[model samples]
Target: MNFFSYLASYFDFDLKILPYCIGLSLDILILYPLLTYFKWHLLSRLGVTLKDKEVIFSSRKNNFNLAYFVNKYGDRNLRIADGLSRKLLHIFSGIWHLVFLNLVIQDTRIAWQAAFVKSLLIIALCSLSYSSNKVFGLAGIMYGATSRIRDGLDGRKNFFIAQLAFLNLYVLVFIEYIARKNISNEDNLIFFSFFIFLPLIIGDALGEIIGTIWGKQKIRVWGVGQINRKSVLGTVSVFLGSLLPLLLVVSLNNLPAEWWLLCLSVAATTSTIELIAPRSTDNFFIPVGNALVCLIFAVYVIHL
Candidate 1:
């Protein structure tokens, strides 16, 4: 089936989840960029100078500005060819990510084959977009090896960088989805959902928000010895981000009240993971490490 048929099948109205799917897509496409630009403006006023890992993303408008880059690319004509192939990639990854959420809330095994289809299709579409949008001088980005942050988005690999960098994460999610096929615990599923989303969303925001507004000192990432783009305040923010959701989980009775140690463990572990994770890969590391910590603590501490 085509993209629309695929999406319609994915979000069958009988499931009554189309709204949530739309919300997730809008969160990634619209809110994500707005927040990125918001940080650029807010941090500029605060004198944080988001020049390093602090500036994680580019504005869609800036990236699509064909007229400005024409002087460099020598392409007098430009076209976006934007559609489901382009937009669906974003929605596909997003909905697949929400599978973890579904596992938590509804005690459902993920539609594994469908999820895989979405993943591969999104990657294919992204690869196509990158090639079509490539400019002459910046064509090298097609390979995903650029070091300079801003340079990658303009190159051929432009949008695929994050996709490759999070290769580990995509594998982990697939593994977890398979594991969930036989398990049946609603609370456990919810735990999985929080474990991924908390660090991915909240921790990410905290790092950027705190690092940009209050952080004055930068430090070399522990595992990434050569990269000193991270700051202590940012690491602390990651910890807080992970910690807050754990608190909510406990409050909601999804986790036991004695989850403090586990909470701190996840916070510290994810923060450390984020600290040393390569640029754009924090989304991968943060959740994987947090998931491991959650399982270990559930078996040892909570059971004890």
Candidate 2:
């Protein structure tokens, strides 16, 4: 037995699933470095990380070099920044979930090629949401903060953008499900509640309410585009609170204990995306992202 067979013997699972795990693990492993290795100042601007020490170095190269990694690993303290990072990390983790779920729990006959296609689709959809949410979400937040909206037009726009994003997500799911011949109302209830409604309502509530209540530091907004809003207390609160509803669902559904891992992954993904994608827009992007994830799970289940 070679590597795939050797591993299969260990888990008593299929080999086709291995690619999914490998792909997700590869993505998860790369996330930190991708966010960290770039320009420190830019990363700081995205609120992806925080900055503490400004290098007063004589050499420009030295100053820039020193600032880079510091921004990546610096203590995250702002609520907004923490929320965004948490949301991004959460999404990445969810992607990992589908990868592992497809490879391990689901059937192996699901060709690795099909799995790759599905993964690509999920990533594309997620990337679209991430980009749009960041663009529109920040615009909404900035508008809310600065622009006058007596008529709540800005809020409406926020809702519209978010709604559009989410609807598109379901469209993709419906199409994908039909393509697979695995569509069912039973799956819909589980998929909708678990991936859609929960992430939007519960994740957001946890991030905003728990975060505001418990977030310790009110880091002064030194400037726009700074991850100055992150707070450790806020992140912990959001992460913890988001898990509550997921736990309840798992219990009520009588899912296996391992399913909790999937739930935890969802909570983490939703929270991180909410933080990073921009405010309000995650309402749409998060659901779409989750829906794509459900497709991956479906792909696995169908093959199994």
Candidate 3:
């Protein structure tokens, strides 16, 4: 317990950081599966054939980007499996954390901590539900739900507004976490502000914007880049998106460059997995990977 305490202090006496990261990561995980389910259902509605082999997926549409998807390692069924694993983990982890929070609150009379943790639990649940629905809606859109709806400026703007609103809410909750942690007096807080907050705002926004614009993945069903689903471009966006958070950690703590590098590596790897992992289960996997990395960081590099 002393060693754990020392490590926690070394990570800046903030128990919330890793847990919050885990929570945020869970949001991403849920989004992945929900989005993928929508995508597949939409494609299937448009008559896209999805055949799975031992470890590969093939679409019957010859001119479609089945070639590219395959090149990217096609395996829809396996992807689905991976996604399920991740989503389950996310639920399990969230429950575990909630239980842990209850125990901590009982043991200590830290008003802010108890309140903040409770708020986090509520926000997390809400975010999970909202993201899940949004993913389904996006899939419905792709499948031509409300087909008469024009894909014009108004529609796109509406979409952008909704997405931005959700993301902003996430940021706001993150700010709440920072406030609850009350690290403002620490010298490192300044670094966290610029690196963490700034980058997160930019990265998530840019990823969505890019995904909307040049996301040229040929819908397996439509045989064209008709659907505004994820793109290779959007996938690469994670590199820039994740860098902000990692940079924040590095800037604040004066840790070795290797530490930051590792953080980036974890983010990149998880983001990539999220990209390819099946939508049916991504809600589970993304957080597990992200939370695992944060915990490892806390235990190994970041903690004293």
Candidate 4:
């Protein structure tokens, strides 16, 4: 047996999935150095190791370049530069996505390619959101794609843009993946495709656009004397905008009247989450929270 067969013999799982893992791994491994070698300066921005520190210089009997192989997280010289770091995280994110995505499609009739594309598109939207700040960036380097989002990948510090990062999208995707398997009603796999994503796309876009055009009154998110304040009209825009997804679900799924009420609940809850969601965690919370609300309404109240 060759490489794949040998590996397969060692680990006992479906052999078909090996190709997915292999292909993704190769892409990440090959692209990482190529991407990072040129942009080593990203290390400093992310507060990781610096690049210009003479690769030939190392403490391992002057034989190894420790920086290249090193790995750690957060403001330190222990890890490689931002490029590889980003790529590594990207690969991790992608693999986890595939894992969850596969779990999502399990027992369902949806096409894997279509689901993968849709999943990537969700990340792309998150990419746009994270880039709402100048010198934009991505989630986990946008699966190791783009550059920094403001002050780099440290989501806790840059929570605003962090919402746009892959972590949030990861949460949304994973939830949908599991929701598909567990939720007792409407398992056409459309909820993940439509209700989950469209709200963010439409609601978020509307919030920004309308807020930019007509936002006047400021609303505090963290409480009195907080720095990050949003406009009332903008917040309203998000609430209204979030409804479109549920409405779409209603229209397409022919959901009962109770679902309409739940849809409204989704919109309202997501908007509220946006307002009070802890600085660094809204991405995961908003989508998952909204989804949970919908599921609860569906299973218990609507009995769908």
lDDT (Cα, 0-100) at 214 in candidate 1: 60
Candidates in order, TM-scores: namely 0.56, 0.41, 0.35, 0.47
- Note the Cα lDDT for every prediction shown: 0.47, 0.44, 0.39, 0.48
Q: What is the C-alpha lDDT profile of model 1 across 1-304, one tens digit per residue?
A: 3434443443343334433434333434543344334433433453434442232222232434433433432221111111112222333444445654455334332332333333454466455544432321122222212222323333234345555544554445543544344344534555556665566656655674465346653574432212235668878887897688777876787556667677778778888887777655665667677777666555555653
lDDT per residue for candidate 4 within 1-304, as digits (tens), equals 3444433332343545544544433433555344444334554564444332222111112333232433333322322232244334444444444444445444222334333344455445444544333121332323223332212233213433443443443344444444544456665445544455445546654664465346753665552111244677777888988887568768887866776887788888877876677543554566677767756665577764
Q: Which is the better candidate, 2 or 4, if ranked by TM-score?
A: 4
Query: Which portions of model 2 miss their true places by more than 4 Å?
Result: 1-160, 163-166, 169-192, 216-230, 301-304
Candidates' RMSD to native: 10.9, 16.2, 14.9, 13.2
Task: Please give the distance, in angstroms, between residue 202's alpha carbon in candidate 2 and its true position after superposition.
Answer: 1.1
In Å, residue 255's CA in model 2 sits off its true spot by 1.5
What's model 3's lDDT at 46?
A: 37
Window of ten residues with lowest summed lDDT in model 3: 144-153
lDDT of 3 by residue, 69-146 (tens): 333443343233322332233334344433443343332223224334444553454334432223334323221121
Consecutive 10-residue window with the lowest summed lDDT within model 2: 144-153
Better of 1 and 3 by TM-score: 1
